[model samples]
Structure formats: C-alpha cells, structure tokens
Target: MGKITKYLNQLIVGNVFDTPEILEAYSTDRSVLKIKPKFVAFPESTEDIRKLMRFFNQIAAKEIPVSVTARGTGLDEGGADLSSGGLVISTEKLNRMLEIDPRERLVRVQAGITLRELNTALSVSGLTIPIGGHNNDTIGGLISNTPVDDSAGKYGGIESFVERVEVILANGECLQTSRLKKYNIAKKATEKSLEGDIYRKISKLLKTNAELVSEMSKNPTHDYSGYPAIVKLQYKDTLDLMPLFFGAQGTLGVISEVILKAVPLSKRPSRVVATFKELDAALEFAHKVKSLRPRKINFYDLKIIQEARESGKNLDGVIRKLEDGFVVLVSFDGRINSCVKKVANIQKEFPRNTKFIFETPENRLILNEFENALAAYLNSAKSSERVPILTDFYLPARNVSGFLKDLKVLEQKLDLDLALFGSYATSIYSLRPKFNLEDKDFNKKAATFLRAGAYIIDRQDGKLAGGTPEGRLKAVVTNTNMKDAEQILYSEVKRIFDQNNILNPDVKLGANSKFTLTHFRSTSLPKIML
Candidate 1:
C-alpha cells in the first residue's frame, strides 16, 4: 500500500482493502478483462467521497497520477467500471433508501441501493420502478449505464424514471440537478456557489451548440458511451444535468443519490408467447403489437430454444408448441379483461399460420425461465479456455432483419459460433461469440468479426454499444463513429468535470488506446456445465 492508500483508509468511514483476495475479486467484471486495482475502498457516505476527492485534488500538485473508478454491483461489460491500476471505490456500502414520498410518488435513495432492495422496499407502498429486473445492479450503476431492458418498450429506461440526481464532481464539489429551481430568483445566489458555477457552465455549453446538439440527439439507438447528449432530451428549454450523468459510465462524476419517479405496482400482470413459421412474420406481428403498446416484445429464434433445451431449462413444452421459425413473446400489465382484449386485437393482426400461447401465472414462471435460459446454455457450450465476447448492436426496427443477416454472414465468414439475444422491441441484439484467448488465430478472427459487425452497425447509423458502455472492446468503433463536433463537446465536458482525467481515464476519450485481448483471466475449464 502507498501513502495515498493509507490516507484513504484512515479518512474513509468505510473499509479499505488491498488484500490479494479482495483485490482479485474486484479485478474483473462480466467483461473479458482482469486488472486488479491498487486499492478498493468501500465508501459509506457522500462525505467520504467528498473528502477523498479533496485529498486527490490536494495531491494533484505533487504530480501524483492517482485515478478513481466507482462501481456498484460489478456487472459491467468492457471493464468501464474497472480501474486499470488506480483506486476502486465500491459504492456497495452506500446502499440506503433515504426517503420515499408517497404523495409525490417519488423515492430518494443512496446510489448503491440495488434494484432488488429498492423494489422490495417499494412493495410495501405498492409502488415500483418498472425498469425491469436488474436485481443485482445498484441504482447508480443502472442509471450510469442506462440499460435497455425487457420493460424498456413500456416504461423506457432509467431516464424515464429518474427525476433528479446528486453528483459529486471530481473537485470534491457536489452538484444537484433537482436543486436548480429554474424559475426562482434565488437561483442567482446559487449561481455564485460551486454547484451553481458547474450548472451555469454546462448550461452555456448546451445553449451555444444548440444546433449540433439537436443533430446528435437524433440518434435513435440507445447509447451510454462518452458524455450523454442531454441538452434537449431531458428538458426542452431549461438545463437538466441529470441526463449528462446518465450513461456516462462514471466518467463525468460520481452519483451520490437519485430521486426517481415511482409508479403504482400493476395488480394484473400477464404474458403471451406467439410463434411464427417465418422470422419476418414474427417481426411483422411485433410491429402490429406495438400499436397496442405492450409492456414488452421479445423475439427468439430456434437456436435460442435449442440452447435452452440443451441446458435442461424445461422449455420443452413451449418448444413443442413453437414453429420451425421464430417466437415472439409479448407481455401486458392491466386487468385480465383489458389484457385479453389487447391479445385479441393482436391476434387479429397476426398471420393465419401464427400460433399463440397465453401464459398463466404458473406458465409465466416457465416463460421467465425460457427468456433467461439461453445465455446460461451458450456459456455452457463454450470450452473453459474460451472467453465469451457479448457485443450489443442497436438499430432501427426496420433494419433488425438486415442486421441479423449480416451477423449470419459474419458467423459463416469467421467460422465462429455466435448466439443472439436481447430486446427486439428496441432493435437491440446481443451477439455472443466464443473465443479462446490462448489461440492467437481465434483471437485475430474474433477481432475481425467484431470490426466487421461494428462497420455494419455504423452503416445503419446504429449504436455499437446498446446496453453497455464502450470500454476497450467497443471504444474504437465509438470513436470512429463519433462526429467531430460531438467529439469536441465530449472532450470539453470531460475536461470540465474530470479536469485531471483521474476518473476512468482513457476508457472512453482516449482514442489511441488499442483494444487488446491479453488482459483477460485465463481458465482451463468452463465455469458452467450443461
């Protein structure tokens, strides 16, 4: 441990660990990268982060190149939340539900509170944040990534529910979006404060480049890479910096707390699975079902069904009912009569050969299993020596079929086994390719396939990273596709927030950083068995 580590341990209210075992645990995430941070600090309060930031700034004059990376549940892809060799601040200890105002239908929570914990607490008041089941992910991580989930078509993402956020900037200054009070004359006094200065600077940047900002905002794909272009998305006229932090992957600042808009829990939730003999037919049905505005619409192929069966997922009954082509699953939440009416309307628009399966409460559990079984099954299929590279591509709904075709071409061209999954409603698909790191030939082939896929997505004006931030693997593509003006704005924003580039440095902005396959953990056997 160094002097800084010792000082952090002494100052922080939470525990600081540099033990090999603990360091190893925090080294890697779901991504194919493993670089143990020098020290991992578990912070309990915002004050602790503030003090640490102040110390970091104080030490900056001494020419110490200390960096900070914050993590919630460690479920990120591409190692965006991982500190290469810097300090890792785990917000797990900061988990707390600060307040829940029933009247306003809003909840204020500490950043590290998990979705599971928040939903459990909200259940008491019959309220919920319908951002889907990222039960293991903390609120901070979820907001930071802005992931698209099963319920995204219905409730949208974290941005839909997030009303405000309290962020701790790099200089130990705290800024709150909800505290701006846009129309209040007292805001002038606040302008003189530290938070006010930040708000003003960012607001001016947005206003000055209004036209370019508008053009960038037109990107339909869901992206959490680089600085969030939040000028017009969150607010029409006034400034709302909360969206800036959303999907920033902690590059901008550390989220301390979030005040989210909550909705009442639906009493009658139901799901229905529809099967089609053709993939195009399934997609057409999905388009029609969108008119009814179903809570979620997910489409799976025969490969997914086969994988689930191989993994012993008990999806045999469902598979038996499915056609040779594709299956579309649609979920609805409302009274039984209302749901039934919507299903009837959906069936009318479906092709004559289409088969529909209405899921009972019992069957719903099985449907959930079917939905989640493929990823586990695919992992089981890969050898222990092979590392899985799950790449997310997002495009317009019309281009989904074409994108799938391109993926098929890449699979054949690369001679790799690729599995597809994700939210069809949002036209975002996850391409999971198996790679053996020890085999140099396999690594080169996988890289070629990824580069080709990135080109395809870019051609369609799609997002290379849909659900995850662009870390080492996808950063090259993100940097390539980013416009000159957007790049300039992102750099300026990053400079303003993280002046020293001490927060997740080079992960997003450093275009020169090459994507290499050497840092991942080596395994002789697969972690999962079929």
Candidate 2:
C-alpha cells in the first residue's frame, strides 16, 4: 500500500488518505458491518475517478485481490458501500449540480449531490427527482441501490426518471449510457474498448435469454437482490444497458454523473389524515390509495403508535387514542380540483362514517410529522436497539390481513415485539424488532428472525429487498431466496461488465452467509463524511 499510495498522490486531484484514523473511520456504513479499507480515495472529478479506477485495474491485472466500493453520504443500511482490505472511493468532493434545463425538464448533476441539496436547487425550477423519500442520501447511493421510491406508485422506478448516466467502467473507460436503437448497440459492440466489450457481451447474453430477460424487465415488485432494472433492457428496436449497471450496487461500474428527468412540482397539494377504528378499513383505504398511485401514502400500524406512546413521545395530533387500529396519511399533488375529485372518489368507496380531516396547518399536523414516532420507537426509554432485520419487504394487496396475522404470530414466537410501518403506496413494510444488542445470542436471534420473516414474506406472496436494498447485511437472505435461473442470469451479467469481479466484490454477486456473519459490526460505527 505504501508504493500504491505514493503513486496515487500524483494520480488525481482529490485527497488520498491511508492514515490509520481515516481507514478506521471509513470502515463502516449505516449497516452493522465494519471492514477497514486499505485506502480511501476522495476523487474530485470524473477524471480523478477514471485515473483511480485505471490504477486499480492495473493492480487487479496483477492477480491481486483488489476491489473498490463507492461511498456517497454512507447512508447504506445494506453493506453495498463496504469493502474489506480494499479501497473505498468517496464521491463527496464531486458533489455539484452541473446543469438544469427547465424547458427539457432535465437536471444533470454529479452523483455525489445529496437529494436534499438537489431538490433545494430544483425548487427554483419547480422540478425534483421522483425517487428517494429521504434527504440525507446521495444521488449515487440511490442510483446504485435503486430502493423502492415512496412515490413509485405515481412515477415508476428510478429508470423512468433517469435519462442518461455517466459511468466509469471497471477498466476506467468513461461510457455515457442511455436508450439506444439496435443499430447503435451494434455500433457500440463493434468498438474494441471495455465499453464496447460490455455492450457486446451484455447485448448478446440478454438476447440469448431474451424471454427470461423480458420477464425480469417487468417492474412489478422491484427486487434489490439482483439488478432491479433488468426490466426493459430492450424494448422494440431500442436497447439500454443502464439497467445492468445502475442498480448493481457499484459491483459493475462506478457512476460519475446522472442526467435525471425531473418532474414538475405539485402546485396545489391535498392531503388526508385519517384514523381508523378498525385495521381493515385503514388497509382497505390504503389499497385504494395504492391503486390511485398518489404522490405520498404512509401507514403506521397500531403497534408503532402504541410504541410511540410508551416511549413518552407525544402523538397528540397523530393518534388521539392509543388503541389497536391503523393511522393512514395519504396525500395527492396536482391541480386543486383534480386532487379534490380524486380524494372524494376514494372517500366514496369507504363507509360514510370514516373519520377524516383535510390536514391543514391549523388542524392536526400529523401526516407530515409521524417520522418522529418512528424515531421514538427506536429510541424508547428502554435500551434495546431496533434491529434492522426484517425491515424492508413487499406485501401484496390481496389477503394482507392474513399475512399480517402471520407476522403477529411470528412476532410473538420471537418475543422481539415487532413494529410494522412503511410507505403504503409502494406496499413496502418495515418490521424492526426491538432487541438488546448486549444479549449474548443477539446475532443468532437476528439471523433466525430474518430467515423466518423472509420465509413468511415469500409464503404470503411478499418479498425481501423491497423497501431496503439487499446490501451485505441481508444479502444472505435475498441471494439464497432468489430463483435459480435468476441467480444464473445475474452471475452472467456480473461477468459481462465486471469480468474480474474487481468492482465491489462480496456484494450482490459474491455475498455469502460467512462473510455476512464475519463482517457485520456490533455497535454500527458509521463513516465520517468529508
């Protein structure tokens, strides 16, 4: 590393830190895993990244075990940003909004820009990225994980919002990817560089398994286990390779910049904060909202509300009575008349006695502030940590009641006191059980809970990697649970762009239970952003 460090000092514009303190600091992400990187590089520009990648590619060519993981904000609950005994490439310094075309409704920005900052800038243009409900995350991180968007019900997955992506390939070649006609793909395949090789091999493989590829192209319930955008690799005569690269979790390529298709901000927004005396009614309304594909719909079950109350958190506006029922907050954004009519139509489907409020500043401000309740649940007076296992999974709309009952039974069996809540619009649920980390058998219990809960989700037509992307922590769950053919296809895709597996190994493709158990941290030491 001494020789490598010296060479890197002159390689690029950004800082290179291999100090013990820096290595220890960048070791972990939001996930409970700590892997001290041999070197952490903060590349300042696209050229810097390409130089670093080229240098690493040369190192890997020597039969050395060198892997690289990209870091942006380090908000990953999954181990997508962790690399043991390798380099951690931080995109922090590259954070910038390059261009905004209000007329074209396109925003080009560095991938390291935080969602909050991007939205802040886009506010002037009345545009915003359609994915990510959280502000603390970076565009690069979101693009890699492709987590289920809170507003996915309205604007499909990230693919719909992403116009083009600038990716630095494993061998440091810069390739700008977008939808291309078959002839353009053919032209790309004819080139002799790494980019050309990727296009040739991926296009060939996708054509070979065209039917399976086509099946995976459907974005019904986006799977974070494998490539989520495997959907529509080719539509009609157009072929796009971004699907193979974007959500592969930096295992395939490093994203430098992203050109996003921004949507118009809602001028007139209407919200409904409804409390249900019965869970059935709330769930029914939630499904209706899901069908309507509104901008926002969040559901907090009775357990969450009760937990909030027990934690000494005031829910004066949100939950009036701490009883066993559901609290739903659904909002629509558009013209005032359209929002009103849509709200009225959904309301008509329910009984006339439904408790409802138009959700105003003067009225109870519950819908927008319930995140504090979730924080309360995690930081209850008790010392138990809210274990992240069983956090993100998709739930089908049909027979949700029976599936929920099974969840309750599972909760009781584990004695972990699970709380259910998440974006109802996406039908994604977060079930984090409270458990004391100091317990001797904490890891065992978490593993058991994760496996059993994932089984129940699959059995009930639900699936893992819905809300949370399957980083290293849940890789054991998502990878093992995948269909055999799907696994094979993902492997081939990994081989195409990342032939040497030099990019972010032991992640989506190379993940195993042994690595998960070995690397998972106990107290979750987070990386310090530069």
Candidate 3:
C-alpha cells in the first residue's frame, strides 16, 4: 500500500492542502525565514485530531516521523513554522466555543478559535478571559504554549486563566491534563531527569522537531518554537491550565481545547498619562505605579511621542514637555470611583517627579499620536543616505536602569539615534537604536550592536531568562556560560518529545543560540543505520 495515500485516507473532517501557493503561504510567518511543508491539514473537530494522531502513531510504528504545527497570527518570533515535512495539522478549522460554564466562571473552546473571536462572543455575556496583555492571540495556542505579556504583572499571566486542556499525544493517545500537572512536572524535573531508550527515541524524534522549527522561520522576536516537552496531567482546584501552556510554545502536544477562567467586563476605564524628563524618571514612575496596578502602562520616548504631536492635534503643553525624554501612560479600569481614588493616591505618592495628565476628550483624540510620529521618523529615514535598522533588547524589571545606562554608553560610541521605552506591564525595556549603514554594512553593525549590548549585560552580572528571540539570542551568543547552559537544556528537552524524527526534517537541534536554521548534509546508509 502507498504510505502517503494510506495516511491521506485516514484523515477526516479536515482539508489536506499541498499546493505551491498554500505551501508558500505556510512557509514564512511574521519573521524572516521561509520553509516548505509537504502537506498541510485543517481538522474540523477534536475527533479529527485524534485520527491525525493515530496516523502519526502508525508512522512512528514504522519508524517514520510526522511533523505537526498550528497557525495563528504569527506574532511570535516565527514559532509557527512546520517541523519536518510529513504532516502539518492546522487547527484553524477547529474554531468553536464548545462550552461556557458561567457558574464555574470558565469557558471551553476549540483550539482553532482566535482571541478576538472568543472575546466578541464573551462580550455579549459581559465576561472575558484573563489572557496576556495582547488580545490578538488564540486560546488553544496560548494554552499549548503559555504567553507572557503586559497583564503578567496584574492578572498573573496566560497561565492564570487556563483551567484545563485536551490534547492528542504523539502516540495517538488522547490525554487530558489539568493545571497542577505542570507543578508536578516542574518538581519531577528537579529530581534526577528521566533517562531510557524511550527517552532516547523521543530525543531523536525531537532532533527532527528542532530541525523543522529552525527551518520554519528566521524571525527575531519572542518566539520559543519548541519547548516545555512535559505534558501536565493534573491541576489544583485553584490552579488553572494557564501555567501548562502559556509559555510552553507548543512542544508537548497540540492543544485541542482549553478551559479558561472568565472575568466580567469593566464598568469604566480612565486614562492616566505621565511624562518624565528622562528614561530613568519614567522607569521610576512605572515602578511606583506597579503598586497601584493599573490595567496597562505604556512607555514612549520623545522620538516616538512626536507621532502624537505631528498629527495636528493640540496637546496640553505636556506634549511640548515630553520632548525632554519619554512618557509613561497608564489606564485604570474598574469602578470609576475606585479608579479615581487610586489615581489620586498615585499622584500623591510621587508628587514632585511625576506629571499626571488626564486624558480628556481632546487628549483622547491624539491617543495614538506617537504612532504617527514614528511613521514620520521612519519615512524621513527611509529617504536618507542609509536605511535605519531596528533592533530591540529586553531587560528584567530591576535591570531596566542598568540596561539604559549601557545603551547610553553605547550611544556615545555609535553615531545612531537611540530611543528607549519602558514597560509597566512587564519587567522589560525596549530600545530602538537607528543608524545609517549600507545594505552590505547592516549585518556588521547589527552584530556589533548586539555584541556590545550582550557584553554590557554580562558584565552587569544579570541572568537573562525571557525576551524576544533577538534579545535572547544577543544574550546567549554574548555570554559563553549561558550559551552552554542553553545548549544542554535544549538538547535534553528535544530528546523527550519527538520520537519519529519526521517533524521538521530540514532543521537541527542544539545547533544555534537562537532559532536560526543551519544546513546539514546526509549520507546514504543501510536500513539498520540506527
């Protein structure tokens, strides 16, 4: 029997696509890398997924590997690349709100549904999921791999809302895991790590998975393509599925459905804007507001804030003052009285250094003025002698000041315009440093900037735990010890989950500090090569 035909026949409730246009569309995400998949399928339901898993198991039984991945908006560091070319199962067709248990304050949804769609449905009921700050992601995808964003500080994280998940394992076994399963796995991982032929086989399979992920995309953002191999099986009543999937980045299994905690819509949301004379002053204000815990804290530099000014919108003189450095804006949501009180308390506590500007009707009109200013800057730069290269770095909350200092020092060395912004949502800082360089010289300057920033971070003795791929890559390549640790951890994890080696055949495991694909040549060998 033809193996491809047999596998194709087994699929139900999903469309199998293998066309040049479709392949090209699936090849690259938001990032830079491009790859081709042999087949892409979209299932209509969880049962369809189970059938796909069974097919994967059948292939594994014959020592054939299968590659799988789901697609969303591709906001990640290009983590959506299909691993190995055997099969790519797209959950996009599984979009459905299976259940919404209002009394339990939880809702169950198929993995294919987008966050925007889910929120629109919940808007009618006046309930919302406690997801990360960005509302553009998917629930099932988030549960498969936990995502961290601005809401991390106040509402816990994407993991906080997840109550449970339904998954189809690699071997075609249907598994349902609760939130507590992660804590147990974390504890188990702390003990002697598991080792065996099964582990060996899984490890081999993951090598293929890693290869495919690397081949999938070359974007430099926060995507951790393959990670969190352990599938959490149990959760505490208070614990939710949020922890299991939020940052897992889709390694263990494809999440078919997610049970999420739901919250009521806000009655009122008040805008509170603050401006600082310097980056440090703005960061200090962010720290203070952390206690007040507003719904969102957005920091913008004068360079970007110009977007607000050039819109021909009149600002309350605060726009003129923002030229001093940066602005920190916070939005308070909840009861109007309580929000007003909290704003008052915050203003009282940091009276001298911070300036609070109420977002009145006129001010509201220019809320996104900064984006316009940035567009103008970019427009002007595009017409200049050299194209501006944009690179970003993330630092932990406490190291924000230190990271800024390092950037300032680097600014003295490079002839570039550096704009720094702080995040009140997370303990991170974003930097946009622009310089004029020829196309041939861009990579060298980019590498130089990355190396310098990484060196400064290493010298400061700060450990980099999380950030976008670009930021994490800079940290890893710059520091030898961290690189070593990363390589070891990556290899160990890859070995445990993927067993077939078919996942993404073109990529390799433990090869790069960041998720960039490197070429490997294969030699013909006997059937019993293993």
Instruction: State which candidate has the highest TM-score.
Output: 2
The better-scoring model by TM-score among 1 and 3 is: 1
lDDT of 1 by residue, 1-530 (tens): 66666878889787777888989888877666777888888888999988877777567647786778889988776777778777788999889999999889999999999999999999899999988746888999998777777778778877799888888888788877753445642364356654666666666777688887777777544676677556443454445566778778888788999999999988656777777777788788888777676777877776677766777778765655443567777777755567667777768876666777787766777877876666565565445333435555677788877877877787788787665666777776776656665564655565576678788776666788776677666776677777788789888888767767777775776623353454655543335322
lDDT of 3 at 91: 74
- Tell me the deviation in Å of residue 187 in model 1: 5.6
Q: List model 3 lDDT by residue over 1-530, tens digit each.
A: 34573556565756677777877566644332344667777778778777776776676768766666655544443234444355667777777898887777789888778888898898888898655434556776565435456555677666667767776655555556543343444443354322223333433443455544343334232333323322221123222223323444454456788778889877555677776676667777777766777776767777666643554434455554545577777766755567656666767765476677776667665654532444444343332321212223345567666766776778889766666654557654444454443344644565566566656655654322233322123323523443343445445554444455333323323224334322111111111100
**lDDT of all the models against the reference?**
0.73, 0.77, 0.54
Worst 10 residues of 1 by lDDT: 521-530
What's the true lDDT of residue 376 in model 3?
Answer: 49
Summing lDDT over every window of 10 consecutive residues in candidate 3, give the lowest-scoring window: 521-530
Clashing pairs in 1: 384-525, 384-526
Candidate 2 per-residue lDDT, tens place, 254-288, comes to 99999998887765456776778777889887877
- List runs of model 2 lying over 4 Å from the truth: 215-221, 336-354, 364-367, 524-530
What TM-score does candidate 1 get on C-alpha atoms?
0.91
Runs with alpha carbons beyond 4 Å of true place in candidate 1: 179-196, 218-222, 233-237, 321-324, 344-353, 361-365, 382-390, 515-517, 524-530
Clashes of each: 2, 3, 34
Shift in Å, residue 338, candidate 3? 4.2
